[model samples]
Target: MTRGTGRGGSSAAARSVDVARLAGVSQKTVSRVFNDEPYVSSDVRRRVLEAAGQLGYRRNNAARALASGRTRSIGVVTLGTALYGPASLLMGVERIVRDTGYALRVVNTMEGDAAGVAGAVGSLLDQGVDGIVISEPIDEAGDGVDAPLRVDVPVLVIGAPSPVTAPTVLTAGDGADLMARAATEHLLALGHATVHHLAGPQGWYAARDRLEGWRATLTAHGRDVPPVVTGDWSAASGYRAGRELAADPDVTAVFAANDDMAIGLIRALAEAGRRVPQDVSVVGFDDVPVAAYVTPPLTTVRQLFDAVAQEGLKRLVHTIENPDADPLPSSGPPVDLVIRASTAPPPSRTTPARGRRPASPSPADTPRPPLTNGGPAGDH
Candidate 1:
């Protein structure tokens, strides 16, 4: 084997020919093994991998790209936020893409950035990505329909409608509405006359879906659809909305868009002398880590971030590998609603809803109780 020395006299980097020679295979067989092309026997493939491992050999992705005209990398356009939902989805995508043997390139776009998905996609295209994943959480549709983005590669858009016109476009994780519907339905099934809604900001497509699901559930059940209380997906906003809802005697149940808001709403209700599952019942979306540990363990719907990423990437990779084949079908995200102590049937008797009553104290100040009436621990 020909070997060269570096400045410090270290041996040259191990190449495919070295791996092939050690494995007793031709250089072409080594290429097939590394490229994951099918015709070789399982035993030969394993031997090639072992030889490469022993020699510390790494495949030259750049050289392969030059020969095949494919970068074997996937690009992701995600919202530049630390919020749990978007961040979790992006992490899931990264994990799955790595496992699929494709390098991942991520570009984050802020909510108010002028160069939005279009600019992000342009950057990925410049880098020669085989496919792209749009994990944007913003409602980019605006007042009018946005002109479809130009992309030559296959694309997978999660949780929202695709804004790009591409050779192959796939979608997954659009089950937020169904999960919200489950939350609302749970409240209704508990014999609450009407369930109030604490919606997320209208600027997000996720928030819109949750709001719509709440409204639709109320309408279907012939219950009065009260005015929606909007929040910015923050605990502070939920507290503000809770203060308003506390003043109304009719709000015996509330369906919050997320767990953070729901926790804040619960605190506000406590301060107003409204006891959870006693004077009021609450259901929240996103079974966050703190959901089960809060004063009154929060009942919530879980978002299937990993599941969405797996299904979406599977379809996207299939499309990239077989250009003429139809995209793989997607099984929608599961609707997992965790039932905890925060939700219950309404109070048997009428009680004052407005000011703090001396008899009733805030749950936040009280000692934490054991969680009961809880469901399975779904994905965080």
Candidate 2:
């Protein structure tokens, strides 16, 4: 359907004369298919393929591939950096691509620039890649994307499409809303009247969505949404933001953008005489590898990075191979709040200043099963 038609809603129909002529068979013999000739055998099919190749004639794959099936190989474009989010996503994509028996062709953006991105994407198309998955940071470099090379191919733009240009796989907007609501709800469940957020840079969509989530949750719960502190997606920024909040004794709970910042918040809170769950409880997002290993594990939200990447890849290739297909929908698995030692009821609110130490979630709280390979993932 993507094949635009000309006047009278008609495009020039392809003729079989070329196919028969190239197959070196009579036009009548080729016509036998329309007549259901039972005599045609395997050898004849071979001749048809040879002739089609020689004549540069192709059966309308739209109708024919229904029988032959698509080829392997999917193209993907992502940030060149080995960041946690992208790295985790690639892990899932690699497993999926292998499981699907499709080869992966990855093109990293050179210098994390827009031109590099455009060039990588174009290279994938030139190879006739069935589909393309883009994992660039929209806040970092995706917002200004000027529509992928050409719109004729199916493209599943990850993290939402720019305006109404093409199909997309998104984990922002509503996804962020859910994340915020869930995070705030957990803190509220722990008895905090309000939650303060140390947000990632405003340019990032995650930062904005997280902020919205925090605000919306606070509004819903009739709690105050404090002014958000901005960070550079670094632990240093988290430390700085933590110091600011630590100066205020009334601030009992904080939600950082990701695990790295959460780590920094820990240092600041300790220096401020706050004993983690015992003083100011903290929750973080992304639940990175180190989250659980910290002195006191952080209670955080786990973004289903694998699911996001898989869905993005699936949508991109589908749209690329089937341009006329309806647009892909926004999809993401729900975020799970991994309760750990980092969060607890507020100190001033729940504990009399004379308690020895706060209680902790025992093995029952983090009953992670063993991984098949016997790794930390399986160990509690």
Candidate 3:
């Protein structure tokens, strides 16, 4: 066997030939084993792997790609934020891509416009990605945006419903429609006369879906739909909305678009002398890690990000392998409503005294007690 003469005269970078010689098998067998191609006997595959490990042999992906005319890498275009939803989706995609023996290249686009998406896609194509995943497409109107949809490779868009030039997958089930209904219904069932919404910023598909769901549910139940208080998915925005809602003695139940805003709302309500669950019940979407640890563990809608990622990755891979296959619309995993200390029945009275502490409820009229700290009620 020939030894590599580069750097300290150490032959640590062994080639497939070296593994083949050591295992008494052909180099093609070693290649097949490393590539995970079928038709090689199990015993031979084991021998090749063991020999490669012993010889410190690594497969040359560059050479393989050159021969195959394809790069085993996928590109991901995502927003440039550390927010939980986008971050979780990226992590999920990364896990699946790594497991499937493909490397992931991520590009963060600050803008959510057509030019921004086009630039990101152009960069990925320049880098020779086999396929692309638009992890989060920004469609503020609930209606799909006309961003550059022209791509030669298979593309999977996460969280887009319309303008289906390519296969799309939503990270949350039924967009925000399912979650809003679940949260609104929960509060209504708890005997709240009406539910108010702390909505995400206008133009966000999520915000639009959630607002529509809330309005639809309220209308369906023959209740009046209150005006939405808009937020930028920030705690500060939620606090501002909370202050506005707190001033109105009639606001008893509030569903914030996300947990961050819900936390802010809680703080604002507390400052305004309105006790959560006792005076005004609050619900949030996205059961983030801190949801359960908050003072009054949050009642929220849980989105299965990992499951959505898995399904999206599966479809993208299938498309990449079978380019001629017809594209199909994909739905995301179901959402669950997690009840905690943050939500309860409305106070017995119609309206509380504005800017004054609400009266304590009598024992018989008390709503269900808050769950124990750090313990969440079972998923609905």
* Candidate order, TM-score descending: 1, 3, 2
Whole-model alpha-carbon lDDT for candidate 1: 0.85
**Native-referenced Cα lDDT, model 2:** 0.67
Model 1, residue 213: distance off in Å is 1.1
Query: What residue runs in model 3 are displaced by over 4 Å at the alpha carbon?
Result: 1-12, 17-33, 36-51, 112-114, 140-148, 161-174, 326-332, 349-380
lDDT of 3 at 334: 74
Q: Tens digits of per-residue lDDT for model 3 on 206-274? A: 787889999999999999998889998888989999999999999999999899999999999999999
- Listed per candidate, the RMSD to the true structure in angstroms reads 5.9, 11.7, 5.4
Q: Give the TM-scores of the predictions, in the order they appear.
A: 0.86, 0.69, 0.81
Candidate closest to the true structure, highest TM-score: 1
Ranking by lDDT: 1, 3, 2
Residue-level lDDT tens digits of model 1 in 188-293: 7667888999999898989999999889988999999999899999999999999999999888999999998999999999999988978899988878888888
Candidate 2, residue 227: the lDDT equals 84
Q: What local lDDT score does residue 248 receive in model 2, on the 0 to 100 scale?
A: 90
